[model samples]
Target: MSKGNIGVTTENIFPIIKKFLYSDHEIFLRELVSNAVDASQKMKTLSSVGEFNGELGELKVSISIDEKAKTLTISDRGVGMTAEEIEKYINQIAFSGAEEFVDKYKDDANAIIGHFGLGFYSSFMVAKKVNIITQSHKDGAKAVKWTCDGSPEYTLEEVEKEDRGTDIVLHIDEENENFLQKAEITTLLNKYCKFLPVPVVFGNKTEWKDGKEEETAEENQINDVAPLWTRTPSELKDEDYNQFYKDLYPMSEDPIFNIHLNVDYPFNLTGVLYFPKIKNNVEVQKNKIQLYSNQVFITDSVENIVPEFLTLLHGVIDSPDIPLNVSRSYLQADGNVKKISNHITKKVADRLAEIFKADRADFEAKWDSLKLFIGYGMLTEEKFYDKAQKFSLFKNTDGKYFTFDEYKDIIKENQTDKDDQLVYLYTTNVEEQHSFIEAAKNKGYDVLVMDGQLDNHFVNHLEQKFEKSRFVRVDSDVAEKLIPKESTLESQLSAGDKDDLTSVFSAQVPNGDKMNFIVAFEAMGKDSSPAIITQQEFMRRMKEMSAMQGGGGMNFYGEMPDSYQLVVNENHPIVERILADKNEAVGKEADSLRSKIESLNGKRQELEKAKEGKKEEEIEQAQKDELADVDKKISELNTKKTEVLSKFSTDNKLVSQLIDLALLSNNMLKGEALTKFVKRSIDLI
Candidate 1:
């Protein structure tokens, strides 16, 4: 036996490894098993090159846990290290300066072990002592045994070993006794080695018999040597990919489609990405895309490797180009990783385009499920947006799908307003906004179903992308005003009459802290409802986007009360009769107050026009005071006119009934107000 200190500059290497690497000590199994796989693969390479004459038997890695002994052992049938090789690879942890090495690497423990050929030493993190017994494949080579007790000291000796492989025994520390359990070992092996290139064996297979699980003689292999991603895309069928998706996510719903990624030139990348049927929430479905390095699971959070939008996809991505152990900044800055990301984005876009061009019916059939993902990509990535626009579809309320250009061409001639701006009418809820949708259809206009969770932001994006185009919710404005082909019909009511009408309807609008209603008149023809509720498009969209984005910048808009325009249709018979009744009820008092208000307004208008181009001192203080007094009188007269109108309007059941009908159509009437409307309906009948 020959014993010497392990070639480490620092005496406290063991403690440093334990202290700093405790966060990721669980990956110790992956490192060990990966090393075993590397050895097995190297043996195959040597045999292929005629370097080794021996027959290469079954290559496998096995893990065993002894609870009583508090030891976990990993054995591999691969090229084992001899004494001299062990001295060079395992013992010598070369560093230029002891103190400097500790200072720099003490913080980045994972980087030190993963990138510095210190994989074997990572065993010290969980084990109190580690022993290696090995026999090299080289002819006449002596078997060796090496031992280290979590210190700089180690022992090396010639040993008797029957097998031409290696056995690593880890005496699990007191704090890490969990590793010395069969169930724990199996779980770790399944997680890190489930898709490893080498077959990994845990223990004997079990069968349920005699009311208990009984171990069988057959060894339980825990890994698949060849996973689906390693296969050729041509060999894979649609069901094959679907089955693989099920294997990856057993509980998730079936994905709409998948994109197989296989690139070779700039960097090696092979994986399958599935467009899962994501619900309204995108954040809940993230971290499902598992990233692998040479079939070994590295991480599920591939945000640094893939674009933020692509992270919503599910499945596996294996690329050897990305370093397994490096700083996040370094991984992000890697040229090959950037190329891989760009390639993936390109591949996804091309695949969607191909599907859209070849089998548009099928693509449209899946559009409801596919739109959320595409819209998300367009919103987040500019490059993806540039590509996605070709295939991104606009689904109309009539269940028809069209590309941006196709829809634009179809609506360009008719949907263009007086300003030559194309208007896109959309409905968030077909059922809730059914009346509004019907009103739009009656106007010979197409309305899109922009009801997706991301559609709020997507419409804003489309507004920026499509020249001279704007998206208007079907319920956001009266149909005639939504896409104004010509100037809208003006209300025939005088200013005083309009104010009285506004006061009449506005007083009956249901009270709520979350919403505000403004009374206005629209000539929507006699066929339209007496009253219709319409929210302003810009403010409504801002509120919607603020709710989705939840950003501080837009929170004010989100928190502000929702305001809607309560448009009274002037052409409707009910509104005409209501005005006639008001004119008879108020008699001549309204006319007298209106004439006096008009006289004051006429004087104030002249003073405002005279003062516009003049210096501030040129206007007397008395003139300014008179203007203020005139405005105050006008407001008081308007208030008196409203009081007269309210007395007549409030008593009229038809006024409240008309307002209730609009509220009911908007799905805003509820509780006592809805109950009162129902009771009022029965009484009227």
Candidate 2:
């Protein structure tokens, strides 16, 4: 018998391993199971090289729990170390026996372990003492017993062992006595070794006998040995892939589509990423991707491994190439990780394109659920956008689908403005914007349904990507101004009449807002509605983004009362009738006021036009006095007109009804305004 200290230089190494080496103490299972897998792989290599001629019996690793004795043993039948090999491998710190073996069999080490090599020390994370009983396959070699008691020092002596294998026993630490529980051990095994290449046995299958559970002879193998992603695509059926998905996420809804990644070149990566049904709220369905290294689950927070938008995916990604520190929680931004990210993006895009090309009708059927994901990818990743443009679909109000070019061609003729910019009309809530959508549709124009959560951001992204293209909400403007292919309209009302209408509507409109509503008269057909509320694409987008970022500094527009344009279609029957019809007794009174307004307007216009050619200080005081008098006269006339309109408005329900209809169409006639409109609507019917 001989005893000596471990060959590590630092005495505080065990303490560091317990405290900071791993992001979580639970990683000890991954570290230990990985080491066992490493040992088994080494034996395979030795046998292939004709070094160990003994028959390699069952290579399954077994993890046994002896709660009565507070002992957890991990056993593997592999290249067990000889007495000499034990001295060099076990005694040395940071030097793994699997590393040397893998070096010799580099060609055969596909998923061979020893990448970290220091995984053995992880046992100290939970154990007060550890013991290893191992026998070499080599002839004339004796089995060795190596024991360590939570220290650098260890004892090694020849021991009687029945088989050529290794048994690792961990005496659970008093501080972490919870490891002695069967439920805890079962959970750790399920998380760590669920997809290891070699079969792993946990405990006996139990059945409820006599109202109590009893262990059966049949041991429960906790691992699948080979998962679906590890197999060739040709060898797998849809059920195999689906079953693997269920294994990964037992409670999630069936995935909308899946992208199978198998790459060996630039870097080795294999996994299945499923496109979940993002439904409506994409932000809520995140953090589902689980990253793995050599089948040992590392983490589900794979933001650095997968793109930010693709984090909505749920599945497994196993890549030995992803070099991890001891914790494996935080992945370093190395070349391999970058290569893997790029590879995954390419695979996802390729798979989507293939599915689209194979059966476009089926793809279209699934587009409502899949569109938000694709749109987000296109907006964030430039490369993803370039690939997605081929398959990214646009859904219209008529339940029709179009590709980028198809939609472009469909709207090029009538929807293009004078500047040759293509206008894409879209609706958010069909029910809320039904009037606007129907108005556009009535003109033989198609409207797109841009109601996804990301549509606000995606619409901004498309305007930047598509040349000479603009996306307009169906309610952004009146139907004619949306495309604006025609010239200006000739209004019968003069500029003064325009100002009178602007003041009346503007005063009645909502106020206390940074948003300003401009009232303009359009010579739309007589049947067109009396008023329309529209938003400028530029300012509204700024306000929408302001609500999301920076802060409420710009939130004046976000929080401020919504400013809507009370665009009175002057050519419409109601407005035209109001202008053409004499105000009866009110007409005579308005005419008398208008006569005074005309005389006052002449003096004000003359004074303003004269001052336009003169320098500011050069104008005489008498000219300023004349301008002030004109303004006073005009104020009196405007006051008189308001009194007349106020009296008419109280008596004329048409004015109130028209305003309510415009407000209702904009979905803004809320609270008392909504109640009054409802009552008035019933009364009118």
Candidate 3:
């Protein structure tokens, strides 16, 4: 027996590995089984090259769990180490047999595991002691036994004759005794070695007999030596890929289509990417894609491996170019990883374009499921946007799809405003905005259904790409002003009448910084509703973004009241009748008060102008005093105006009813206010 301390620069290595890597301790099985696979594959390579003149028998790896003894063993039939080879590879820290094997069979050792050389030491992660029983295939080489107790010290010596392979037995500690179960070991093997190059066997197949499960006549193999990704695309059928998807995600609905990736140059990448049918909440069907490296499962967190948007896809991606042990942030900075990301993005774009060009009807059939993913990709990646514009479709409410240029041609003439800006009218909730959609349709305009969670950001992206184009919600403004053409109409009511009218309508709606009521006159006909509410784009966007982040229960934007444009059509007969009634009831009294208010307003304007260019604190005291006087005069006139308006609100139920009608249309009338409106409608009728 010979032993020496494992060479390490720091004593913190073991503790660091235990503490930091504890979260991923289950990966220890993958590391140990992978090492056994490496040894098996090495012997095959040597035999192919005439170096090892020996029988290359069954190369299957087997793992057995001994619950009573708390032992988990990984056995393999491959090029095992001799006594001396054990000292150099197993005794020294970080030294790996895969390195020597790769050097000997440089071009033929497919899927060697020596890149990081941490596979062997992964045993220390869970085992209190590990034993290796290996016999080299080299003629006259004796079988060897190597043992270590979670430390640098190891014992190795010639053992009795045995098979030409290795079996690593892990004496699982009390804390990790759970690994002794068949299910636990099976799950870890499936996660890490299900697609490895070598077929791995766990134990004998079992049968339910005599009221119990008993080992069958055959060995229970746990993995497929080669998965669908490593196969030739020509050899694979559509159903084969679909079956593979089912294997990856058993419960997922069938994917719309798949991208078979088999790249040789730049960096070897072999995998299949599928576009799943994603609906409503994004995470309902998550973790559909399983990431692998040379058939070894590294992680499912492929955010940095693939673009953020691509995570919505369901499939497998195996690329040796990605490192095994590192944070996602590191992968983003690695140069090769960036190239891989760019390549995948281009491949996805090209695949979609091909499908769109070859058979658009079939592609369009899947558009609803495909729309969110493409839109999200275009929104997040600038290059994807550039490519997507060619195939990215615009679907009209009539269920017709069009490319950017095609849609622009169809709507350019009718949707262009006086300023020559092309407006894209869209509706997020088709049912809720049905009235607005119908109005736009009646005017011979097309409305798009842009309702995806990312559509807000996507529409903003499209605006920047399409020259002279803007996306407008169907109800952003009244039908006529939505695409304003030759628009200008002055209000005819007197200043006092305008104030009284505003107060009469505004008194019904809640008043706060959030609940703003912008009183505007429109030329809409008498048939149009007397009042309408429209949200401003900027404030609405802030609120929508706040919803996306879910930053807190309710953010500042959420806390702010609803902002609405209280549009009152001045051209309608109802308005003419109201103004005429005001004149007859308070014409003389309002004219007298209006004269006083107008004089004070002119003085207030003069005072504001005098202080416009002055430093905030440097304004003259008299100027401040004069502004106060003007403010008081305006306030007094406003008081008299409010009294008249309050009387109007109490008397004219039609005004309040009209306001409620608009609020109902916008789906904003809620709770007690809604209840009041229902009761008032009965009384009015």
Candidate 4:
């Protein structure tokens, strides 16, 4: 027996490993299992090259948990270390200055493990003491037993072992006795080694017999030696891919499509990315893409490995190039990682384009499910946006799908405004905005269904990408003004009549604090609705985006009241009759006040013009007094005019009816207001 200290400059290596790596201490199982796999694979390689004459039978790694003894053991049948090899590989942790290394990276767990090769030493994180019994495959090699009790000191001695492999026994610490549980160990193995290259055995297979589960003689393997992603894409069928997806995510819906990536040039990368049917909630769909290093599962959170938008996809990405143990900061800064991300984005885009070109009908059939993911990618990654344009589709309200260029070409002749800008009309809700959609259709314009959760941001993105193009909601303006081809129609009402009409209609709008109604006259012909509510495109979009973003910088838009234009068609017969009836009821008094107000305004304007070039002292005190008097009389007359109009609007049911009709069309009239409208309609009938 030979006993010596681990060659480390500092004596606090074990405590440091336990303290700093406690957050990710669960990875100890992964590290040990991966080491066992490496040994098994090396044995296979040596035998293939005729370097070893021994039989490489049953290359498997088995995990056993002894709850009563509080020990977890991992045994492997592969090339193992002898006494001399153990001294060099396991005992000697060559640290130039251990104190300096710990000080620089004490806070970063991955940095410490990755900077120095600490795969074997990580067992100290969970185990109070660890023992390794290994036998080398070399002929006449003596088997060795190594023991360390969570310290730099260890003992190495020759031991009798029949098998040419290794057994790592971990005496789980008091605080980490959970590792001795069968369920806990199984879960850790399933998460870290489910797709490893070597078969991993946990315990015997079980059968539900005699009303309970009983162990069978067959060993239960927990990992697949060859997962679907490691095979050739041409050899796979649709059913095979689907089965694999079910295995990965048993509870999720079937994926829409998949892309098989196999690249070896710049870096070795192999994986299968599936386009899952994403819902409106983006947060729930993320973190489904599992990242692996040489089939050893590294993490499900692959945000650093893939673009933020691509995280919506679900699959397995295995690359030998990606370091298994490293900080996310390191992965994000690595040049090779950037290259891999770019390649993945390119491959995804190309695959989408291929699917679209091969079978457009099928692609169109799946557009509803695919649009959310495609829109996210286009909005985030510029390179993806450039490539996605070829296959990205625009779906119309009529359920017809068109490519960007195809839709642009079809609408360029008619949808282009007088400013030579293409106008893309869209509707958020097919039923709620049905009236607006029909009005747009009546004008020979096409409207898209932009109702996705990300459509608000995506619309802004499209505006920046497409030249001379704007997306307008169908309900944002009157159909004639949405894609204006001619000059706007002049209002037929006089200035006074317009004011009285606005006062009459604005008084009846519901929820004055929450909603703001701006009354304006538009000569949209007698066929148009008497009163229609329209929101400004830009303001509406800002509010929508603010609501989705949960209000940071855009919170200003969210806090403001909803503004809508109560567009009264001056050419409509109902509006003209309403004005005529109002004039008959209170026009005489309103006209007298207006005449007095106009005379006072003339006097006030003359006084203001007379003193335009004069200083305050130069102006006579009597002239300023007269100017003030004129302003007071004008203000009094305007107040009387407003009173007369308010009285007239209160008595007129037609005014309330028109305002309610517009509100009801916009789905804004509810509760008592709707009841009042129904009652008023019955009384008129």
Best by lDDT: 4
**Which of the two candidates, 2 or 4, achieves a greater TM-score against the reference?**
4
Question: Local distance difference test, per candidate?
Answer: 0.83, 0.81, 0.80, 0.86
In lDDT terms, how accurate is model 2? 0.81
Comparing 2 with 4 on lDDT, the higher-scoring candidate is 4
Candidate 4 residues 1-685, lDDT tens each? Answer: 9999998889998898787743487888988887788777667766766778878898999999988888999999877887887887788773312224345434431112123446677788899999999999999999999999988899999999999999999999999888888888889999988988889999998999989999999999999888999999889999999999999999999999999999998998999999998877899999998888778777788888899999999999988677533221134457788899999999999999999999999999999999999999999999999999988999999899999999999999989999999999999999889889999999899999999989999999999989999999999998879988886667788998887888777666664777787887777877889999999999999999899889999999999999899898888889999999988998888888888888888888899999999999999999999998898888888887887788888889998999899889889888998999999999999
Instruction: Extract clashing residue pairs from model 3.
Output: 514-561
What is the model-wide C-alpha lDDT for candidate 3? 0.80
TM-score quality measure for candidate 2 = 0.91
lDDT for predicted candidate 1 compared with the true structure: 0.83
When summed lDDT is taken over every stretch of 10 residues in candidate 2, the lowest stretch is 576-585
Tens-digit lDDT string for candidate 1 (423-530): 988999999999999998988899899889888888888899889889899999888899887665666667666777888887788657988888988777778788
The clash count of every prediction, one per candidate, is 0, 1, 1, 0
The sequence of per-residue lDDT tens digits that candidate 3 reaches over residues 179-211 is 888888888887888888998998888999999
Q: Which regions of candidate 3 fall more than 4 Å away from where they truly are?
A: 3-23, 209-214, 283-287, 326-333, 488-496, 512-514, 550-559, 580-592, 599-633
Each candidate's TM vs. the true structure? Answer: 0.92, 0.91, 0.91, 0.95
Q: Which scores better on lDDT, 3 or 4? A: 4
Error of 2 at 207 (Å): 2.4
TM-score of 3: 0.91
lDDT of 1 at 653: 85
